[model samples]
Target: MSSNGSVVPRVTTRTLQKMRDNDDPITMLTAYDYPMARLLDQAGVDVLLVGDSMGMVVQGHDTTLPVTMDQMIYHAEMVGRATDRAMVVVDLPFPEGQIGIERSIEAGVRVLKDTRCHAVKLEGGAEQADRIAAMVTAGIPVMAHVGLRPQNIHVDGGYRLQRDTDRLVADARAAEQAGAFAVLIECVPSSVAAAITDAVKVPTIGIGAGSAVSGQVLVTHDILGLTTGYTPKFTRNFAEIGKAIGQAAADYVAQVKSGGFPSKSESFS
Candidate 1:
């Protein structure tokens, strides 16, 4: 609980591990700006990720590859300012952590210092262990991303489910061994996701994986039905907010044109 008497406790790496141990499912959502971060924090989300997906969802980019570290830091700082309890994790962005171990550490440090986020999330698994290790050794908490990495979208052709159970399990294990506090399992078969979750000591957060993992996450825009086109099959729209917003605007315009709005009560005395 905070000084404001909020029931939501502050989320941290240790808190996430404890949640996994207790069989409590964690909740995470992406927020690239302050308003969304404030709403998610108020709703008691366990984690708020400033994901590189913002490149597509917010900036209208075709891929996350073009998202720069400076853009991530700018958005992350806004999220950090709005959130008080949820653990904030920002993506290190493409090529930032993939350049080399030294470059990875530099990126991680810059992200933490500039954004005030709790940790930096980088895409990769066994192949990224050395970089992950170096970042952790530099005192930067890292959240490892395994399975389908968006940073590798061009190489992989497109987003596809990872079916190699053995590879998934090995990647998760390697990340844990490399000192990643948690691993995000994305776009993998349910069986593979479950296998990795079971094989890893650290908490596994799944996106389009399944319920058997430690937790689940989704892009906030997708969940709220704010995304305009090509929604993923795994994404579930919980609300028709986009339609509602459009309807509200139409109603306001009609009322104003008909001189039915800003009636006596809305007028100044």
Candidate 2:
């Protein structure tokens, strides 16, 4: 049973589709490590995405550009092992969808076989139709991304809100028609996100895209305020965990300085 006293079944791509049909809101979060993945899975998140955002969240990098496939697989393996109920989907870091179908197939197959993840998410749209179709044909479950692709950051010049409704809707449709199990709409207007949701038969997960979609997702570190410094405007820090951690460290320092840390109960003797 889940913490809510209900049965927690293993989440699947089809499960997300069913939730969309039933008007049930889906929940997804990015988790790169085993401990956090376990906690989030136990908390009943529907999906745990091992996002390339780890380059920024874990590696202290300025962009996700430097993240490699090997790094992704390593983190994904950890997240996949820790998850029991949540469907774990790892991102195909930059160039996975940009390249040809043959290499993409190799990458997708490797991720599933090596990490034991349920699915792979690639950033792209209509242009990636053949790749998405081919990956699905290879027995790889694909989650397609549309609107404000992060891999295109250098091309886009920065992280800007995507507002092209017709294009976004077309991308979502193409991904669904190409056999993507779900479409993730990111950093777009709520109306556009909703249109994409309406346009596609599959489930639409959103990040900066708003609540009108079938589900929502956020960088876990950003949500818990564990990520120091700037976060996206669309993100909300549900708890000041970083502050608490800092306070805990400060308290320990104070205790040690005051000679009160080695109390009889705490001492080895």
Q: Give each model a TM-score.
A: 0.94, 0.95
**Residue clash pairs of candidate 2:** none
Per-model lDDT: 0.91, 0.91
For residues 163-222, write the lDDT of model 1, one tens digit per residue: 999888988889999999999999888888889988987899999898889999999999
lDDT of 2 by residue, 1-269 (tens): 56667776899877888999999999999999999999999988999999999999899999988899999999999999997799999999988768789888988998989997989998989999889999999999999999998899999999999999998888888888999999999999999998999888899999999889999999999999899889899999899998999999999999999998979999786
Off by over 4 Å in 1: 1-8, 259-269
Q: In candidate 2, what residue range of length 10 has the lowest lDDT sum? A: 1-10
Any runs in candidate 2 off by more than 4 Å, and if so which? 1-8
lDDT of the structure predicted as candidate 2 = 0.91
What TM-score would candidate 1 get against the native?
Answer: 0.94
